[model samples]
Target chain A: MLVVNTEFVPGFEVTKVLGLVQGNTIRAKHVGRDIAAGLKNLVGGELKGYTELLTEARRQAIERMISQAEQLGADAVVNVRFTTSAVTAGAAELYAYGTAVTLAGGA
Target chain B: MDGDAATFNFLILLVPIVLIVLGAGVGGLTARTHLRSLERREAELTSIEVNNLKFVRDPGSAADTRMVLGQVVIATDYFKSLATALRNLVGGEMRAAEGLMNRARREALVRMLEDARSMNADEVWNVRFGFSNISQMRGKQGAMQVEVFAWGTAVRRGASA
Candidate 1:
């Protein structure tokens, strides 16, 4: 599927609007990663483990959104957006949402 | 026993002072180095244009288009955290925390641009940023860190255009 974060995809027109599709996931940092992040904080630098954790969560959220779009027979997902919230001290929720639409040309 | 107690008291006093000094020296160096690198990379990647506009005018026959993402998590050193803590008492701006956030944002943006460059895209559109504070514990302000995520649609122009 063609996914773009813009309202309209270039070279294609939307023929059918399938409304909004969304996916979300909440993940908590494990003890090992948390400990690593704590030490890294002392010297103040990028937390690679946390970055990977978020990347994985975001990818899963987007994948879930895409699957939902596929269920709606969408040719593309447009105007996609992501948001994050700290559900708890060590856990975060990642949400991906977008409009699913059928384009004039198939992906 | 008295001497041991006295020595213990002195050690307690010395630890914080040592930590603050180490934080200042190392953390300051890290931030400076990172800023320099950001400047150099930004100059190198000036060829690719990026914007937040939802739509592109005359996209020049787009060959390919897709979403790109960049993410980063950054934390403040002990010195900044202490500085912020003290600033909280005075109710003033936390310049140290501000610098940390700025660096994280720029790093995320630069990474997004690099992702676009890898795709051989000429322009990025509809850029958006997402952020969240992670690592704080319940009922306590633990290590302070911020996560910045930058995303956009990368467009590569067709040969015809």
Candidate 2:
């Protein structure tokens, strides 16, 4: 599948339009890391704990998006974008979405 | 000049230095943690690198491509942020975790895009991302995990065999 940030692929062409497709996920890490972070904050530099937190969260969200595309029988996605929001006091949410379509060769 | 006066003056200076070190350490740690978290999250999204291409035989229908993208991209980003925020608190030498995650996202996206291209798809249409967090949130046996996904339609342009 030819995927590009632009709506059109210079060398490739679109052939069909599939219905709307999307993916979403909700995640909450254990609070232990947070407390550790708070304490670590007192000493300051890099909070190693939160680094792990963000890494894990990003993985989960991306996984869900891929699964959704698979269900739609999409070979590729283009112009992918990411967004985030605060769901609760301690929890946050990440989401990804894009267009799904079929393509033809330039030749 | 008195001995007592000298001791008192020394103690006052010592107190400020100690407080400053403690304050600086804490501030630095907190900032690092927050920055690391953001980077780690970006890495996570990069880990999968979901790519979607949508296209049709008729160029006139190109408008629909944008329409679908409007929803798909927003949703994907939303879910990606959600996952990152959920894991925002995880700490301990986990700084720069985003570097790894970003790599993963890119790898995944490239692989999927290559697969689509091999299928002779000119583009992908109606592309969107989906996310799921199957990890348990409560209880001693619970685990935390986030999955990010990117999806789209592969199409042939101007009618193909």
Candidate 3:
């Protein structure tokens, strides 16, 4: 499925609006990784553990979003956006939302 | 007793001077190096056109659309930490920390542009950034940090629309 953050797709035209579809996930690393991150803080650099955690969460959220779009028979999802919240000290919530639409000519 | 007191006073005077010199030296060097690298990389990406405009004027045949993302996380240096400590007392703006955030945003954008350029995309639009911190300030879970993430769509414009 075609997915973009723009209001409209360049190649395809939107035929039918399927309203808003959303997906979200919350995730956290284990205590071992948190301990490693605490050590990494001393040197000052990228916290790889947290990065991976967020990336994975985003991926899962997007997958679920896409599945929802598919159920709505959307050919593309436009104006996609991602948001994140620190639900707690360790866990984070990532949400993906977009407008699902059917292409005019059908891709 | 006199000699020991004098020695103690001398050591007390030397410590902060040493810290200031260290902070300035390291902070200056890091800023210089980062600026040089940012300039070099920016020059290399001069050809890749990036904009936040939603529409492109010369959109070619609708080629393809794909998501591109760039992210960077920066931690405070000794100088910034020291400055922050001072700022906390006076409660004014923290220039040191602000500079790091600026650098992170620019660096993240550059990386995102590079990614789009590598994908053979002529332009990217509707760019957005996400800023967050990890497990910082969770009572020893981690040190403080700032993360900048840039995301956008790389579109291959149609040759003739």
Clashing pairs in 1: none
User: How big is the positional error of residue B101 in model 3, measured in Å on the Cα after superposition?
Assistant: 0.4
Candidate 2 chain A least-lDDT 10 residues: A38-47
Q: Is 2 or 3 the stronger prediction by lDDT? A: 3
The sequence of per-residue lDDT tens digits that candidate 3 reaches over residues A14-93 is 78999999999988757887777654444344567666666677888989999999999998888888887777776677
Clash number by candidate, in order: 0, 121, 6
lDDT (10s digit) by residue, model 2, range B1-161: 69999999999988757655665455445444644655665464342223333433455433222211211100112222233445566744433335324433433344345555555555554455544332222221112222334445454443432
The segments of candidate 2 whose C-alpha lies over 4 angstroms from its true place after superposition are: A1-11, B1-19, B25-161
TM-score, chain B, each candidate: 0.93, 0.35, 0.77
- Runs of candidate 1 with Cα error greater than 4 angstroms are B137-139
lDDT of 1 by residue, B1-161 (tens): 99999999999999989888887888899999999999999998899899999996574488889899999999888888888888889997889989999999999999999999998998999999998878553114845788999999999887876
Question: For residues B27-121, could you state the per-residue lDDT of candidate 3 as single tens digits?
Answer: 56666677678789889877766777776444336577777777776665555566777888899888877777887788788888888888788
**Where does the lowest 10-residue lDDT sum fall in candidate 3 chain B?**
B135-144
CA lDDT, candidate 2, residue A98: 60
Among all windows of 10 consecutive residues in model 1 chain B, the one with the lowest summed lDDT is B135-144
Q: What is the C-alpha RMSD of each candidate to the true structure, in Å?
A: 1.7, 13.5, 4.1
Q: What is the docking quality class of candidate 2?
A: incorrect
* Chain A TM-score of prediction number 1: 0.96
Fraction of the reference Cα-Cα interface contacts (below 8 Å) that each candidate reproduces: 0.68, 0.15, 0.32
Which candidate order results from sorting by lDDT in descending order? 1, 3, 2
